[model samples]
Target chain A: MQPDDLSRHLAPILGDRLIAVEPFPETAGRVRFRREGALDLFRAMRDDLGFRHFSTVAGIDWVDHREAVYVLWSDDAKQYVLLSVDLPAGDPRIESASGIWPSANWHEREAWEMVDLNFDHHPDLRHLLMPDGYTFHPLLRSFKLHEPEELEVKARHV
Target chain B: MSEMWINMGPQHPMTHGLWNLRVKLDGEIVVDVDPEIGYLHRGIEKISEDRHYNEVITLMDRCCYVAGFSWEHLYILAAEEALHLAPPERAEYLRVLCDEFQRIGSHLMWYAAFVQDIGLMSPFLYGMRDRDLVLDLYQSYTGARMTYEYMRVGGVRNDLPPGFSAEARQVLDWLSRRFDEYDQLTLGSDIFRKRCDNLGILKANDCVAHGVTGPMLRSAGVKRDLRKDRPYSAYDRVEFDVAVADGADVTARYLVRLEEMRQAVRILRQVLDWLDKNPGPVMAEELPRWLGAPYAPIGREGYLLKRNFPKGVGFSAVEEPHGEAVAYVVNEGGEHPYRVKFRSPVFSNISAARKYLIGYHVADIPPIMGSVDICIGEVDR
Candidate 1:
């Protein structure tokens, strides 16, 4: 099925959850959906939407807004949906989508490490790409990676 | 059933890369598995933010060090998409040829490792000997053995200098002969067959649900090949069959990769023909340097293959030798990608380990794991 065929099939369920749907030209009718909806929308996308394959769950800090997106790709449907969930800039917290998709287990933990987000129901959430005691969210635009004694000493490539 | 914590290491012979799989075991059988990662993660993502587009190929080279082309291929494809740069037809063919050779190399190693895991010593020798031939082919062209920074943003870093086609032909000829010997040694062997065939079976439904792709998925009767379904580069030009075996066991997985190497060789032969006919520009016009690439060379000659990338979002996912390699790049109209994510093959394949490894003996774990050919750099990355 063409990507935009979802609009005709399940527009009622998708309602205002999807903000914009555009057919990417170079990608051969591959559609990108920008979503801003409740946690149930995330659930439906996994269960009902045929986006059974969970690609990635990560965070993006937009200076003003710290947002996390769950990118899901449905091989059966040939569509790409970006579930852009809004999280408060200060103390970013949201419900984990791990219960819905099993692949999100590590990706969610990575998000929690990088963006400092609290996943309400993420079982065994911990530091994935970083150390346990690493407090600062390194991916943030504001966070300065000031050069110290270690990076200078451990420099392999000049 | 007594429950006990079992740590299958950040370092183990069966396990690849640096991952500590904390398995809660009821005696020898596992109850639940928790995969702990990041032991070997060099923070390539964080480092990429400060580098240039072309220079990042070095980092990409290390992503899956065994099959380096697959890693760099995905990165460059995403880079091409981000910069709206399409490689020349000849360049695409060259890339595909190298890719196939790398696939052969990876599968050979995997076969050898799998055999060794299952208490077969001769098969491991047979596997490594054939693999070295493939690796030798890579070394002759690329000038390095393991990690090759051959793939550039718009085109390859170095072109087929001269008579590379004839050299490639010689390698393919040797590989084709060696493949026959390998087939007789491994597949034809009775002991290997008894251990592998119809063992650790993964059904088609389970394969789809777990997001398993490549030979493993094809072994499970899923005739879905990204090379055929979504033909990128010169794959569309060449006509070849996607090798499928409808047996979802260790043997089936073994056969799939084996047949895939044969197909890859066939593709290389065809691609070499195309290369002979077409010898022209490899890079695209109007290159935009990527902001987030590493610095290269001495002096201010600046970065090689550096282009200012368009501030947009583009994703390139192609079926690598191992599995589907997806590279997601987000450009904020800057010198670097604002964010880049590599969807590694090992993630899904390793996740499916729980399904495959649950009921099998600890002795069977190695070959089963080896069949999937998990690249640790990819798993943690």
Candidate 2:
């Protein structure tokens, strides 16, 4: 369907929580929603809008606030609709889309470890790209990186 | 006998890359599988946040060694969108040329590795020999076999050299004949069929739910190619069919990848024909001064803080040789991207290992995972 179709489907369900559903070139449109109504919007987007295929969930550190972007595709509509949710920088937590979309599992894990966005109620949120016990979230703007330095990595005893 | 966990990688013959597959086996049958990645992780996304827009092309080459051009094309598509730049018509066709050739090269690499995993010795060498021809074609124009930082933001770095299309056409012709030989070597063998048929079956719903793309999804009878469904770059201009199969098994994946190579040859012919008639500028003329020359020094006044740069987020999904690869670029009005996240198809394909691998024989892991075409660079990037 088109942008208007998405707008019409999501309007009554989301009410004021749905920020906007504007037309985006090369895509059906980008659907912006508040973090509070994430689960409601995700379910509606999946079952109601026919966007069964979930592509990815990327977390971006906007410095002041954190942004969680979810890309969903509809086989029926033959289009992609981007769903972005904004969260507070200090404690960036949002309802996990993994419950609605099984594909969101790995994407959520990556987002959580990299950008420090907490996926509340995620089935298994763990360090995807980082070693276990790794402390820093390297994707954050505050995590400063320097030139490669030689270090002895301790081997784990079996 | 009791069930026990076996580590198949971190340097196992079954694993083609630097990752571990911990499989729990109950008398040669796989009880469970846990894929442990991050061994090859170089933090490419975090590093992208510190580089110039065009300079990020260097890292794309390291993403997937076999499909560097495809990854480069993916990043440029997103970076261009984020920066609000448009490439020329010829540049678009040239990019298509890069993609189709990369598809052949990557499939050849996959063919070599997958067959070798199943003990098909001769076809392994044959696959590499044919792949070398594609790499030769890449070397002639891009000046690098593996890591050609040829594609720039807005457009490519340069136009095709003289007689490049003729040479490319010759390689395509050779590859088409070799495809028949490839099929005969693998599909013709009884042992090949015995090892592959009805093995590693992942249903259509499982494929979609796990976010599997590329040939794996296509093998499951899903016609969800981004090129056809959501045509990007010069895919809209070309006429080609999406390669698909209904088996959703190892053999079906083999057929899908083989058919896809032929289709890539089909697309390359069209792209080359279009390129021969159209000759134009490769790079966009309206680019900012800093982006024009990525490495050169600018005046004391840094263009990194340029106010004219329109801040936007660029999302690009390309049907890479492996699968559907997505790149999200956040510009945020800086020379460096605020954030860059890549969705590697292999990552999700590997994540669903527990779904497909659990019930299969432990011995079947190689051909199954090999058919998925694990590229650790992109998976860990």
Candidate 3:
């Protein structure tokens, strides 16, 4: 299951989920799907079909759109199957795959920190790598970079 | 035999990074271990949003400081994928050259740290001394000691300076001999071998189940490597075998890393030959280096831009020094990445502690941890 198999074997399955497969023109053997069918298709892919490892999950906000990408890796066949589902531009929510792969626990939390996506059914879904009560989703397109008023002055290492 | 909960570091050296592990110990024996992370979380993902596409090079350095160079490569590839840029053959070969050297350098540092975890200090010094040589090579190319921003989007930032290969050859020649010395000095000393041979035996099934990558997974008898399976850069062109060990123990893990360093040297020599023949542009003609970076700011902007920065979604999984490191880049497609999440190898590989550490003595933790070689920077990043 090398990268070549991704376009051939995984595309049809991903197409069925998003209802239509959108080719990732930038990267070969890559595609995107809609948000609705992400969970059910992911469950089938990870549990039954043997894409055992949820390699890495990423959530992104394109201002008018939100996305959750699940990269499912099958060690036996060495295939990488990607699942991308889109949400509305403002609010984002998706079912967590931590039940299928424990690695998702951190990935999902990180996605929440970056994009403010609420992972439903995520156990202990706190800010994994960001501060608690941090409001802004930095990754969102609308957010602008600001200058902190307080300066953290420290002695330079001599 | 009452079990008591003992807190280990938001700052302990053994715990590595800012992680706090609450282990229930029943008198020098580990009954249970619960790891708590997120003390050093700097909203890197949030900050990645505000920066420009080129600005990501700086943040990627912080992802895994030990293997900062490789993370730079990963981010570059991700950006290149997004922008549809392919590096010239010479640049790809140059990247493979540095990547292998950095891999060896990273493993050497890990070896030193692992030994220190098990209470060996002198070897740490020896390891660091050699590691600097690799860093010196990095400096020659990128002009920085620790965080080499050598890698840029389309390709590398610059070409190798003249007289660099002469110096690298001397260093690689020395590193080859040093690998043998390390084997004789520490591979199976009575104390080291006893702790490593069968302890932390993560079976083949467990390796896949736990998502262990690199030496740890290979030690567990799975011949799975992104480099081998999905050959990237010049890996498909190169002639180096994937190092694997079947023992699936701490010793096997140690051996796999040590041997990988030797194999890296082989790949480096081949790369040098390829570099000599191929001489052209280091970076893609389309993506310019002086996009916005003037002198490289590490000041107040680091805070204001800490959150609500760069925006886009790019996942970069590269063969870093410590197994597989995937940097999930989420951007609103702005100047910075909206979120830059590091899927560190240590996080999942360490989670298997319960499966390996239970029923073992407390004294065994250090050696088992040593084999894993956790770098707090990556763990915390």
Ten-residue segment with the worst summed lDDT in candidate 2 chain B?
A: B293-302
- Sorted into a CAPRI-style docking class, model 3 comes out as acceptable
Off by over 4 Å in 2: A147-158, B293-307
Against the true structure, candidate 3 reaches a TM-score of 0.86
Candidate 2 residue lDDT tens string, A8-102: 99989999999998887678898889988899999998898888988898888878999988988888888888988889998899998888888
lDDT of 1 at B290: 30
Give the range where candidate 1 chain A is weakest over 10 consecutive residues by summed lDDT. A149-158
Q: Estimate, for each residue in B52-161, the C-alpha lDDT of model 1 and write its tens digit.
A: 66667888878888888888888888877776767777779888987888888888888888788777898789889878877777777788889888877777756676
lDDT of 1 by residue, A1-158 (tens): 44466555445666765554555533323322333344666666667767776667657777776777666666665655655566667767777776777667766777788767788878878666666656666677666555542322221112
lDDT of 3 at B348: 72
- DockQ-based ranking: 2, 3, 1
True contacts kept of each: 0.34, 0.74, 0.57
Q: Which candidate order results from sorting by lDDT in descending order?
A: 2, 1, 3
DockQ of all candidate complexes: 0.39, 0.78, 0.42
**Interface RMSD of every predicted model, in angstroms:** 2.3, 0.9, 2.7
Error of 3 at B92 (Å): 1.0
TM-score of chain A of each: 0.73, 0.91, 0.74
The TM-score obtained by chain A of candidate 2 when compared with the true chain A = 0.91
Candidate 3 error regions (>4 Å): A1-17, A25-39, A63-65, A88-91, A130-158, B288-315, B328-341
TM-score of chain B of each: 0.92, 0.96, 0.90
lDDT at position B336, candidate 2: 81
